[model samples]
Target: MKTVAAIALYSFREAVRNKILYSILFFAILLILLSVVLGSASVHQDSRFLLDIGLFSINLFGDIIAIFLGITSVFQEIERKTLYNVLSKPIDRATYFLGKFGGIAMTLAVQLLLMAAALSATLLLRGGSVDLQLLGAFWLTYVESVMIASFALFCGSFSTPYVSGFITLGVWLIGRLVQELAAFLDKVEEPASRHLLQGIVALAPDLNFFTITTQLTYGYPVGLAYFGAVTLYGLGYIVVAMGAAIFIFRRRDFI
Candidate 1:
């Protein structure tokens, strides 16, 4: 456990030092700040506009960061031939994978908070309170990003970083549009084809479960129980995905 923690801290430090991460975070905060100007254009709904823009900025860039970290974390190690040395230590492959994922998750959570805080601060400037719905929405998005991170790590375990990033982003897009895919499922008349599509959708992460944008936008209520459920779901998905990544990593011949 200490070994994993050590590796995780190392990874967190390494990731935070990446110039690209800071660049992306800067843009994300910039977009949120831009909301202040854009929000003013709308008459009497500056808060709502800011909310919309801020949420969009955080969620979009958060996913990008998640994918970026997952793709680069282990791949960089292998590329620099450091993975061989790391694996040569007493730690098993599973420990290394878990540590990497933990570090990625930690880095993402911190970045999410930074973005979320920027949004909240902007909202306060616009006379909007940092309400529960907004927080819930942000939490859900982070949960969604965490799932994507785990999935990208799993992909990077077997494929090149380019392929892993592409596949991860593709899956994320499909997952986000899961509602549209479900509506299309009703259009299919053939049972076999419909079932196949259904299976694919079922196997895919239900990102819609984490979406509360409409509710947040409209000032609808979101309960604590729902937040608990969503949090648990995200944690569960990460565990399963990390297990698969470890399974694949263990089988790889890194010689």
Candidate 2:
């Protein structure tokens, strides 16, 4: 456990030095400021528009950072031959994998907090208040990003960084649209095709379940039950993804 913690801290510092993370974060803040500007132009529904755009910007940029960092976490080490040195030490393969995952997750959590703070400041400046529902929305967004990070880690364990990034991005896009895909599957007349779609739906992460932007924008009430259900779902998927990553990493020959 101590070794895992050390590696995790190292990973966190390594990720902090990545220029791409800052680039995405800059754009995220820029977009949030732009939302404030655009929101001011509207006579009515300004707050709604600002909150919607701000939340979307946070989610989008956070996912980008998560995916990029997760894919490169292992690949960068291998490319630099540092992975061999680390593996030669007392650390077990599972510990190394978990450390990397923890580092990336920690980095995402920090980034999410920053973005959420910016969003809150923007809302306050616009005469809006941060309520429990708004905080819940941000919490769910962070959870969603964490899930993406885990998926990226799973892909990185077995594939090159480029291929891993592509696969992770594809999964993310599909995960977000899984509901629409399921709807289309329901219209399929062929048994085999329907079955395949059903399989995809069952296997894919239901990202829509994490989405609360619409309700937040419209000031609708979000139930605690909904949050609990999605939180459990996200945690379950994250565990599976991380376990798969550890399993694959243990089998790989670093030599």
Candidate 3:
């Protein structure tokens, strides 16, 4: 427990010190501000339009941070020989991996909160009423980003940072389209190919579950059941990805 906490703290500090973190954050704030400006052009109920833009901007920027930093977390440590020094201590591979994951998760949470604050301020300025659904949407967005972060970490455990980045982005795009792919596969004439496509879609993550943008924007009810299911799904994927990362890292030779 002590080892995990210590490592997590160190990782958090390292992530905070990175220039990429601040650069993305700056751009995210800019996006939130820009959303407010664009919202003024709406002809009807400009508050709804502004609120939607604010929430979506935050979610989009948070995702960009997760992909940029999460993919490099482990890979950067390994590349810089920092992993060797850390491993030379009393820490185990699984503990280290979990700590790194925790650190990245915390980093993402901080970024999301910052974005949320910016969004809130933007909405308030536009005379929009704050809705609890927006908060729920933010929570769901965070889960989705964390899921992507775990995938990136899994890839980084065995591949170069550049490769992991590309793979993570590709998987994210595919995850959002998995349902569409499944539907298309069902319509295919060939049985064997259809079955193969079905199998592939099943293996892919269903990112749509985490998407609540349209719902929050339109004042739709985001029920608790969907939140529960998405949370569980995110946990399941994170566990699988972290397990794979640890398995690879345990056998890595840093000599």
Candidate 4:
């Protein structure tokens, strides 16, 4: 536990030092600023556009963090031979895996907060007021980002950073389309093929549950049960991804 916490703190510091973190922040701020211009273009997306802009910023930047930071976490250590050095200590593989996951999760939380604040500022300036449910909506988005980070970490365990990043991105895309694909499959006449698609749907992460940006933009109530279920699902996926990362890392040759 001590090792996990210590490593997590160290990883967090490293993540902060990485230039990409700041770059993403800059881009997020840019998005917030542009929201005004974007909102003015189309009332459908802009007048109440702060929420959508903010949610999009979080989702886009969160994805950047997952791909850039999460995928490189372990591979960077291995490239520098730090993984071997760390493992030589009293630390176990699981602690190392969990530490990376914890550190990235913490980083996502910080990023989410910054994005939310920026979004709120834009909304305030635009003469818009956020409902309380907006907070829950943002939290759900953050949770989803953490889940993506975990899956990215798992891919990083055995693959190159590029491969891991691409795989994580693919998973995110698949999760987004899983429901749509299922519906499409149901309309198809090929029973066997449709059933195969159904199986994939069951395995894919239900990303739609995390995407409440539409509701936020239109000021819809996000039910407590829905939020709880989404949170539970995100945590469950995070655990599974982290566990897989540990399993793969245990067999990794860092020498």
The model with the greatest TM-score is 2
Question: Quick one: ranking by TM-score, best first?
Answer: 2, 1, 3, 4
**Residue 57's C-alpha lDDT in candidate 4?**
81
Off by over 4 Å in 2: none
Output the TM-score of candidate 2: 0.97
**Model 1, 143-187: lDDT tens per residue?**
888899999999999999999999999889888887788889999
Error of 2 at 210 (Å): 1.2
Question: Sort by lDDT, best first: what order?
Answer: 2, 1, 4, 3
Per-residue CA lDDT of candidate 3, range 74-117, in tens? 88888899888888898789999999988888989988988888
| C-alpha positional error of residue 39 in candidate 2 after TM-score superposition, expressed in Å | 1.5
Each candidate structure's TM-score, on Cα atoms with residue i matched to residue i, is: 0.96, 0.97, 0.94, 0.93
Clashes of each: 0, 0, 0, 1
Residue pairs with backbone atoms closer than 3 Å in model 1 (clashes): none
Candidate 2: worst-modelled 10 consecutive residues by lDDT: 36-45
Residues 104-213, candidate 4: write the lDDT tens digits.
Answer: 87788888888888887778777777667878878888888899898889899989898998899988988989888887885878888878888878888988889888
lDDT of each: 0.90, 0.91, 0.83, 0.84
TM-score of 3: 0.94
Candidate 2 local lDDT, 1-255, one digit each (tens):
988889999999999898889999999999999988898888887888889999999999999998998899999999899999899998789999989988998899889999999999989988888999988988888899999999999999999988999999999998999989988986899999899889988899988888899998877899999998999999999999999999998999877
**Between prediction 1 and prediction 2, which has the larger TM-score?**
2
Compute the lDDT for candidate 3: 0.83
